[model samples]
Target: MNIVILGAGEVGYHIASRLATEGNDVCVVDQDSERLQVIADAMDVRTVCGKASYPAVLKQAGAAHADLLIAVTTNDEVNMLACQVAHSLFKVPTKLARVREQDYVRHPELFGRDDLPIDKMISPEGEAAKVVMGRLNVSSAQDAREFFNGAIELVEVTVRPKGKLAGLALKELPDVMGELAVYVVAHEHNNRWRVPKGDTVLLAGDSIYVTVEKKHLDRLMKTIDLAYQTPEGRNVMMIGGGRIGYLVAKELEQAGAKVKIIEFNAERAEWLSEHLNNVVVIYGDALDRKLLEEENIDRMDDFLALTNDDENNILGSLIAKRYGVGHVVTLVNKAIYMQLMRQIGLDVTVSPRLSTVATILSHIRKGRIHGMASLADGQLEVLEAEALATSSILDIPLKDLKLPGDTVVGAIMRGNEIIIPNGSVAVKTGDHVLMVTTGESVPEVEKLFAVHLEFF
Candidate 1:
């Protein structure tokens, strides 16, 4: 596919790199020549240096023959205008813009084809908030993503030192946990990731990704030693008044969570106080130890450092953890700090760039894939694809299917029922199949679920 990406920032760079790796003809546009140069030097992609919204820039980026146009400039207006220019002047088939402002996203009617000509709108804040909320909901999960319209869930949890399932082998889990209905899709041990086999044993500090039915989530959590029950009112402290922080506070407050926000900017703090009801907004710096102590950070159920600055967020989250906060969730934009944050005892690290890239890949993947998530910093991928009648693996018991070495069938969603697959389970046509696989195995897994051309 010929693709034009309007932005050379983190999200744009990662998307361009992945698409180019997959053999797509990718061109990136940005006003900053330095950013374009960085992309050009790092990847096999064409880069355009000019204002993204300009018609001449779009044409230079090959928008006229582009199969897809993705506008993700830092400015909301620029992204919107770039999409409009792509659609109006070049007739790009798929126009996706990264819109950040809540005002634009709140109004759905404003984004129609006749109105803005954007086929899809991506919100980094909204996507990050969704990930944060998912983690909070699971409580014990480092990451939680739903698939097949919430019928199935992919949850990542670290094995505790004395946990019940810490040293248990894969084949002994069901017997040990008393008919537990979950699939251990992937395991990360000492920074090495693999699709576990029956003999694989989970060790302490290993992060295990599992697929389970939503209704049986509590059972899985209990088995893994994660907190499954919610207290009367969970106390959440947010250290930012930006878009992601506000959205999280609002969602948590509506769900009966006692929310408090600390913003360094007094104006933004005042705005948050006025806009959000039942949430305490303080005009203070998160890095100030005195302010954190005054706010009783140690007593909070969760501490989230979501400021735009990666250094501040990392420092704030470290201080919170030092003060014995129950859970510390930090937002890190740079991918380099992800492992470092985890090593320093952070509970969860949410990346807007990774979230945005995952959202983009969901739409970009081939076959009948309805959802996609990048896990373990893009090394692993969890995908949900529909099983077609002509699929090669259809109606065959999973044990007999010759799947790729790095792939695991996590769960199957059939209508209202969610099935945690076993050896006896055979995939049927129209079933939404969730698979956990390495990045290299995605295409092979997709082919397994794809309909054959002979059927048509």
Candidate 2:
């Protein structure tokens, strides 16, 4: 596919990297030569240095023959204008843009095909809030992803030393749980990632990934880890009161949890207090331990370090961890620092920038991909798609199905019934299939599912 990307910032960089990895013909445009050079040297992508909204720049980026145009410049007007120019002059079939300003976000009706021409409007703050809340639902999980409109959830939990699951084999899980449904999709032991077979054994320090029906999520969490507990009217505190923080805090308040938000900027703090009726808005720097102590950090059931600065978020989350907070989630913008966070005991970190990247990719994927998630640092992806009648894998039992060695079917949903698939389970037409696969195996998975029909 010929794709043109506007802006070479964090989101654009990751998008180009992923699309290029998938062997797409991608061209990136940005005003910053240094940023363009950085991505150009790192990935197999064309880079154009100029004003992205200019028709000449779009033409230079191959927008005339491009399959899609993505505008993610920092300025919302520039992004919108780039899309309009791409549509008016280049006739690009698909246009996606990032619009984050509250004024623009509050009025989504401002975008339309006739006027704005933006096929999809990406909101990093909104996606980040959803990611944060999903993690909170599975507090003991390393991370969690929802699919099929939240009918199924995928969670990863590290096997703690001496935990009940540390010594069990993969095949024993179903028997141990009696009639409850659960499926072990993959495991990450040491640095190796693979689909776990029946003989695969669980060991301490190994990351185990599983999928279960949403109704049985809590039961599965507790069964996998003896120490797992549900959050009950808990105190949830956030260190940043920015847009992302406000969205998360508002959801937390509506969930009936005690919520508090601390903002470094006095004006924003005042605004948050006036807007959020239930949340306690504090005006203080999160880096000050004295302020956190005065707020009774130890009593917080969940501590969110949502500041924009990666260093401060990391340090603040570490402090919350040291205080024995039940769950410590930090907002890390840079992908480089996120891997370090999990290794240093902060298991969950949200990247709004990368979250927006996933949103864009999901919009670009050719199959009827309901949703997609990157796991194991983008090496692996969980994709949910509908099974077509002509799909090669249908009617054949999974045991005899020829799937990529790096792929595993996590769950299947037929109407309202959720199936934790096994070797004998066969997929039916129109069933929503949730599968996890490596980056290289994605194309093969799509081919096998007969989801080759075009989708924007």
TM-score of each predicted structure versus truth: 0.95, 0.96
- Positional deviation of residue 77's Cα in model 2 after best superposition, in angstroms: 1.5
* Candidate 2 collision pairs: none
Per residue, candidate 2 scores C-alpha lDDT tens digits across 1-456 of: 899999999999988988798788999999999999999999999999999999998999999999888999999999999999998988898999999887888887888887788989999999998889878877888788888888898988888888878788988876778788888888988757788899999998888888988888877766756444444488988999988999888888888889888899999999999989888999998878899999999999899999878999999999998888988898988878967766788878888886888888777776667778887666688889888887887898988888897788899999999999878999998999998998777777878876552545
Sliding window of 10 residues with minimal summed lDDT for model 2: 223-232
Q: lDDT scores for all predictions?
A: 0.86, 0.86
In candidate 1, what are the lDDT values of residues 1-456, reduced to their tens digit? 799999999999999988887678999999899999999999999999999999999999999998899998999999999888888999887888899999999997998778998878999999999988887887668888888888777888888898887898999988756876888898888777788999999888888888888878888887666776442398889899899999988898889889889999999999998999999999988888899899999899888888999999999988888888877788999988987766788858899999999998787665588778999888888888898888887988999989987988899988888889999999998988888887777777878987221100
Cα lDDT for residue 430, candidate 1: 93
